[model samples]
Target chain A: MTTLLPRAGARPPGRGPRTAARRRERLTALGMVSPAVLLLLVFFVIPVVLAFALAFTSARLISPTPAHFVGLRNFTLLFQDPVFFRSLLNTAVFAAVVVPVQAGLALALALLVNTKVGGTNFFRTVYFVPVVTSMVVISIVWMFLYQKTGLVNHLIDTFSLGHLHGPDWLNDPSTALPAIIFMSVWQGVGFHMVIWLSGLQTIPADLHEAAAIDGADRWARFRHVTWPGLRATRTFVLITITIDALRLFTQVNVMTQGGPLDSTTTVVYQAVHTGYDQQQTAYASAISLVFFVLVLAVSLVQRFLTREKD
Target chain B: MATTPTPAPGPRRRTLRRIPGHLLRSALALLFVFPVVFMLISSFKPDQQIFADLGSIKAFLPVGQLSLDNYTAVFDRVPAGRFLLNSIVISAVTVVLGIVVNSLAAFALSRMRWPGRRLLLVLIIATLIVPFETFALPLVWWVNKLPWLELNGFHLALTEGWLDTYRVQILPFVANAFSVFLFHQYFQSIPKELDEAARMDGASWFGIYRRIVMPLSGPAVATVAILTFLPMWNSYLWPLMVVQDENLRPVMVGIQYFFQLNVSWGQIMAYSTMITVPVLALFLAFQRSFINSIASSGVKG
Candidate 1:
C-alpha cells in the first residue's frame, strides 16, 4: 500500500518558454523509459494478467482443442488434493525453519567478522564463495556428499561419531527436506551476513563508546544498541529468506526431483511439475496465483510490522 | 579488590583472547569453503580415488590418482564446450542490454523531470514482488507466439516465434525491475547541478546521460553488470521451459543431461567445476563491488 501510494505533486508553476521546456523534458523522459516500459508490459504485466485469467480455465498445454472456463474448480481441486496440501505444508515448514535459522546464523557470522580481527576480508570472501556458485552446481556437489557412502558419512565415522551414522540424506524422506534446508542455509548465510555487516557498519561508533562508558558489557551493548539498529535489516532478511525458501525448486529438481516420497515438494516445484511435466496448465496457474497472493500477503505483513512508529 | 591497582593486561593476554575468536572464525569459514574445494579437487581425482579419499580430510585435498580423466568424460557425456559457450553468450548479451535499457529508464525516472515518473517508478518497483514462477507459464505461451527475425541460411526471414533461441533466453531478462531500481537509486545520489550545467551548455538529454551521468556511475554500472550476468549464467527454469533443442541449451540445462541412471560422480564434479569456476573467478575479481552492490540493494546472489 505504501509503495502504491502516489506522491504529492512537486512541479513548480511556470508559463510560456518554461512550458515548452517542460514538454521537451517530458518527451525526453518518455523516449528514455519507453524501451523498459514496453518490455515490462510484454513480459511482466501482460503475462501476469494472462496468468490470472488462465487460472480460472481448464487449460491443457498439449491439448489442441480450445479450453473452457471452469470457475473456482482449479482452486477447489487444489484445496481437496492431498498432494497439493502436502506441498503447501512442506513449503510452509521449510520457510518456518530456514528463515530464522539462516538469519540467526548470518547475524552471528556478521558479528564474528565485525570484530576488528585480522584477515576478516579473506573470511568474508571464503564464506561468499558458495553464494556465487550456481544452485545446480551446489546441489550436484551436495548430492555426491549426501550419498550413503558419501563424504559426510565418512567424515562422521572418521570423527569418532560413528554411532550416529549419517542417513542417506536426499534419499530418505524424513531427512530429505532437512538436508536441503541445511545446504540452503549453508549457501545463503553469507548473503545475509553481508547484509547484516552493512547494517552493523551503519551503527554509529559513538553509540557503542557511550554504551561502554555507561558500564555496559558487550552483551548489554549488543542487546540495547546493535539490535535496535538492525531492526529493519533483520525484517528485510527474514522476509527475503522466507520468499526465497518458498520458491525452492532448483535444489529439489537437481538433487531429489521432489522424491523419496515428495518430502521436498515445494509450491514452485509443484507448479513446475503440474504445469510442465503433467501439462495441467490451468491447475498450475491456480497454484501460482495462490503463491503470488501468499507472497504479497507476507510482504505486506512484514512491511506493516516494520513500519516506523509515529 | 577495589583498593588494589590492577596491572594492564600484557600483549600476550590480548593475543590469547584473540586466538580463540580467530580460530573459530577460520573453522566456520572453512566449513563454507570446503564444498567448492572438494568439487574442484574431486574433479581432478578418478571416481574410485574420490570415494577412497572420502574417509579423511584428504577428500578435499588435491592429492592421489589425480588426472583430467573426469574432465574428459564430462566433455564426452555432455557438450560442455557448447553449453559453456551458450551460457557466456546469453549472459553477456543480457548484461549489456540490461545495462543500457534499465539505466535509460532509471535516468528518466531519477533525472528528467516529467509527469507520471513517480507512478512509473512505483509500477516498476511493484513488479519486483511478482516472482517469475508465478507467471512463467504465461510468459512461455506469449513468447511462443512472439515474432523473431531469423537468418535462415543467410537469407533473413521473418519468424513467428522466439523459442529455442539465444534471444528467448536473453530478451525477457534484459528489462529487470531490480536493476532499474538500483540504477534509479544510484542516479538520485548524483547531483542535479551536473545535469543542469550540461543542459545549460546545449547538451541533449542523451548526451547528458552519456557524457555526464554514465561517466560518473562506474560503481553502479559494475553492480548492475555483475547482478545481471549472474542470473543469466545460472538461468535454469526459463530455458528449460522454452528451449528443447540441445544445441541452444544453457549450461544449467546441460546439467540434467548428466543426471542419468549410472551417476558418474567424478564427471558430475568435473562438470560442476567447469560451470562454477567462471562465477568464482568473477566474484574474486569484483569482490568489493559485488559485495557493495548486494549490500546496497539488499538482493541475494
Candidate 2:
C-alpha cells in the first residue's frame, strides 16, 4: 500500500549516509535469507537435478562407477515392467476409491457438526482425534485388527452366514489395497471435515435466511447456496486429497508390504523396494520420475477441473 | 438496517419450533467416538479374548484379566523410553530450529525491499509441489559426501560412522520451505505501518522483528510448531532411510517393529494406545487453538 520513494523527496538533503545504511540493510537481509536459500539449493534444487540426471544413468546403490549414462534404458525398462503396470493400476484404483469416499465422509461429518445442534464440538473433537494420532501406530493397530484371526473376522463370523468366511485381509490381494484405503479415509476425513466446517461458517447467515424466505428447503439451500460459496474450499480439499492419496505409503508398507502378489505395491512403495532391496537405484529413480510425472499430471488435471468449476 | 422487535417464542409457537438436530448430532458424535472407544477397551482385554469375541457386548465386558501386562511387554520388547526421548528431542530441535530460521527469513522477505524478492517467494513456494521421495536419493548421496560426516574429512573427526547420528537425522528436516512460506504469509499480513513506526523509533530490522512482529504472531508460531511437530513425529520414510541403528529410531519407526515381534493383538493395541496417548492428549488440550488458528490463517493455499 505504501508508495515507492522518489529520489528528490528525501527528508534529508544527503544520500551518502542513507545509501550506506540501505546497503547495510540489504546485506542484513541477504545474511538472514542465505541460510534457508543455501539449504534449499543444496537439498532440494541440486538434488532434483542430480536425481533427474541419475534417471538417465545406470547407477546401482553401492556401485563405484558413479553412474554412467545409459540413455533411455531405465525409462524403457520402466514402461515394459509388468510390476510397474500393476502398481499404476493399483494406485489408480486406490485413489479412485479413497478420494471420493473420504470427501463424502468429510462433507457428511462437517454437515452434521455444522448444524444448530448441541454437542457439535464434542463430535468434531471425537472425529479429529485420529487425525493427530501417528499414522504408523494406526497402521500397526489396524494390521492386528485385520489379522487372520483378528477382530474384523470375529465380527463377520458372528453373522453365521455360510458364505461369509473371512479372508486374511492384509495378505489377500483382493482385500489388502481396499482395506488400506478404508483406513486412510477414516483417519483423514477429520482434517478435511474441519476445513469444510470453516468453509460452512464463511457462508453468511443472511443468505440462508433469504433462501428460507423463498420457501427453499434445506436440500435446496445446500445445493444452491452452500455448494457455490464452498467452491474454493472444495477446490483446496480436492487438490489436497489428490496429493495425499498419491503419497500413500505407511499403511501399505506396514500392513501388506505391497504383497500377496504385489497387488498393493504402489509406485512409491515399489521405488523404495527397488532402490533399497534390489539395489537398483537408477531403475528406482526412473520409476520415481515417471510416478512424479503421473502425480503432477493428475494433480494438474485436478487443479484445472476445480478451476473450471470455480 | 431498520430493526423490528419480535415477541419471544411461546410454548405454542409453531414457526420457531426446534428440531431434534441435537439428538442427531449426538448420534453422529457417537459414531465418531465408537472406534476410539473400541480401541481403548480392547487395549485392556486379554489377547485371546479380543479376536474370539469382537462385535458382541462380550468384547466390551470388563475382565479381571485386565492388567498392565501389555504396557510392560511393550516397554520390555522395544526401547520405548529411548524412542520417546528421541522423538521429543528431534521434534523439539526441529521446532526450535525451524522457528528461528523461518521467522528470520520471513522477516527479511516481508519487511526489506530487495531485488529478486518475488522470485525468491516463487522459488520457495514451488518447492512444495515436489515430493520428498524424489529428493531422497540425491540428498543421501550429498549427505554421504559431507566431510565432517565422513571418516577423513577436514574436521579431523576421529569417529568413522556418523551415518545414523542425530545431526544427519535432524539437519535435513529443519530447512523446510513450507515453514518459511508460512511465516512469510503471517508476517506480510501484519500492517507495514508497524515496521515504519519502529523504523521511525530508530529500531533495527532485527530489533523490530524480535520486539514487535514475533510477539504479534504468537498464533502463527503455535501453528508452525504443531504442523512441524506432526510430520516430524509421524515421519517414517526419511527416518527409515537414514537411521539404520535400531537404537536411534523414533517411536513411529519403533512401532513398525511391533509387527515383526509377532505380538498378540491385545498387546499390539496396547502399544498403539500407549504411543498415541500423548499425541491424543496434546490434541485435546490444544484443539481449540489449533482449530482457531487454522480457521483464521487461511493457509489452504
Candidate 3:
C-alpha cells in the first residue's frame, strides 16, 4: 500500500514555497479527522481524567452542594467494605475460571466444526446462536432455566434417575456466581470458537499434511502444529475472556443484581451500584480507578506470560 | 483434522468413520442452541402449558397449544413497541454515524500526511485498552453536567445535562476506537495508487474517499457496521445509568422494566423473543460478514 519512490506529480521537496494544494491537504485531513478526535476527547479522554480526579473528591451524582477533595476517604472506606471485597474476589474467580475453560472449549468446538464435512455450516451456526443472541435475553432465559424446578434441574434429575435435586441457582449464595459464570461461558464460547476457526484456516494445509507424513498422530499433530499455530488467537481469546469476565456487569445486573448476599457482585456491577443506583459518584469513581488498574495489571501480566518465549 | 476440503472416493466404508465425529458435533451443537430453542418455543405457549411441558423434551418443542396471546399481552403489559423503536433508533443512528465518522478519520490517518497523524493514531489506539466500564460511571456524571441546546419558547435555549436523551446514547458510542482501527486496517488494503491517480485528475481528497476509496471498501464498512451495531444494540449498563425517562430507554433497559412487576414467564419469553429475533435474523443473513468481523477483531486487534 505504500511506496518509497516519490509520488507522481509530486510537489517539490522544499520546506518553503509549499503549494496551495499541499496546504489544503493538511486542512482537509484535519477537517475530516476532527469529528472523531473531538468526540473521543470529550467522551473518553475527559472521563478517564475525571475518573482519577473525582476519586479524591466527594462528588454526588446530582447534588446541589459542591464537592470538596476528600483525601483517601473513599479508598479507606472501600478497603473496609465487605461487599467491595466480595466483588473483587468474585471478579477474580470469574476471570480465572473463564479464561481457561472458555478458551479451551472454544478451541475444541472450533476443531470439531473445522472439518470440511457436510453440515459444517449448520454446526457452526448452531454454536454461534448464543453469540448472536443478546446477553440480556440469554440471562433472562437462563434465569428461568436455572430455577429449582426449571428445565436444567429437571434434566439433571432425570439423568440421575430422580435422585438428584437442584437448589435455586440464582438464590443460593454458593451457586449464584458459578451459575452466572456457566451462562456467561455458554453465551460467549461460540465467539471464541469463530476466532479459533479463522485461525485454523490461516494455518496452511501443507503444514498439517507434512506433519502427518512425518508420522504424527492425531494428538501429536494438534499439540505440535495446531496449538502452536494458534498462538496469536490463543492470546486474543485469553485476554478477551479475562477482560470480559472482569467487566462482568450485565449478566449479574440482569440475573442477580449482585444479590444472594452479594455473592455474585462484580467490580463493574459494584461500580454501577454505587455510582448510579446509590448516587455516590465519587465513591464509584474510586472503584473505577482501582478496577482500571486491576485490568491494566492483569493485561500486562498476560502479555508477559504469553510473550514470545523462543 | 482432515487436510482436504473434500474427502476422496475410496473404500465405501471409509466414509463411515466420519459419522461418530458428526454425531458428536451435532450433540454439541444441540447443547449450544437448546436454550434459545426453548425460549422461542416457550414464547408461543401459555404459562401452565409452559410449566407442564418443562418436565419433558416437549419444553423445547411447540407441542402444546400455541398462540399469539403472549405477544399481544406483552404490548398491553409494557411499551414493547416503543422500546424496540427506541433501540432501533439508537443502535441504527450510532452504527451509521460510527461507520462514517470512523472511516473518514481512518482515511485521513491512513491516506494523508499530516503533522500529528502518527501521534493521533497512537492516541486513538490507546483508548481501546480502557474498557468502557471503567469510564462508564464517570461518563454518566460527565454527560449530566454537559450542555445541550434546545428550542425553548420559540428560541434556542442552552440546556444543561444530556441525561435521558437519544443523543446521549448515540454520540458517545459513535467515535469508537475499534471501529477506527478496523477501518484503518481495511483501508490499508486498498491501493494508495488509486488515491494518487484520482488526485492527479484534479479530484478533491474527500472525492477520492467518496468516489474511489469508499466504494471499494464495502467489506470494511460491513465489518465495522456489524461490530458497531452489536454493542450499541446490546448496550445495557450505560443506558441503565444515563437514561431515566421510559420513552428514551432502549430494549435492554426496557427489559429490566418488564423484568420487574413480577411478570409472567410467558410474557417475558415473548418480550425476549421479540427483541432477539430481529438481531438473530440479521446474523443469519450476514453470517459470513459477522463471523469475519468477529474474527478480524481477534486476529488484527
**Per-model DockQ against the true two-chain complex:** 0.63, 0.52, 0.79
Give the TM-score comparing model 1 with the true structure, all chains together.
0.93
TM-scores of chain A across the candidates, in order, are 0.92, 0.92, 0.93
Local accuracy of candidate 1 as per-residue lDDT tens digits, B94-213: 999999999999999999988899999998998888889989886776787788776889799888777788888988899999999989988999999998898889899999999989
Q: What TM-score does chain B get in every candidate? A: 0.91, 0.84, 0.95
Better of 1 and 3 by TM-score: 3
Ranking by lDDT: 3, 1, 2
On the 0 to 100 scale, the lDDT of residue B9 in model 3 is 67
lDDT of 3 at A69: 97
lDDT for B96 (candidate 3): 86
> Which candidate tops DockQ?
3
* Residues B8-118, model 2: lDDT tens digits: 556325333544555666666665555566667778877776655565766656654677787888788888888888988998998898888888888888889878878
Q: Which of the two candidates, 1 or 2, achieves a greater TM-score against the reference?
A: 1
lDDT of 2 by residue, A212-246 (tens): 99999999999999999998888788877877888
> Candidate 2 chain A vs. true chain A: TM-score?
0.92
| TM-score per candidate | 0.93, 0.90, 0.95
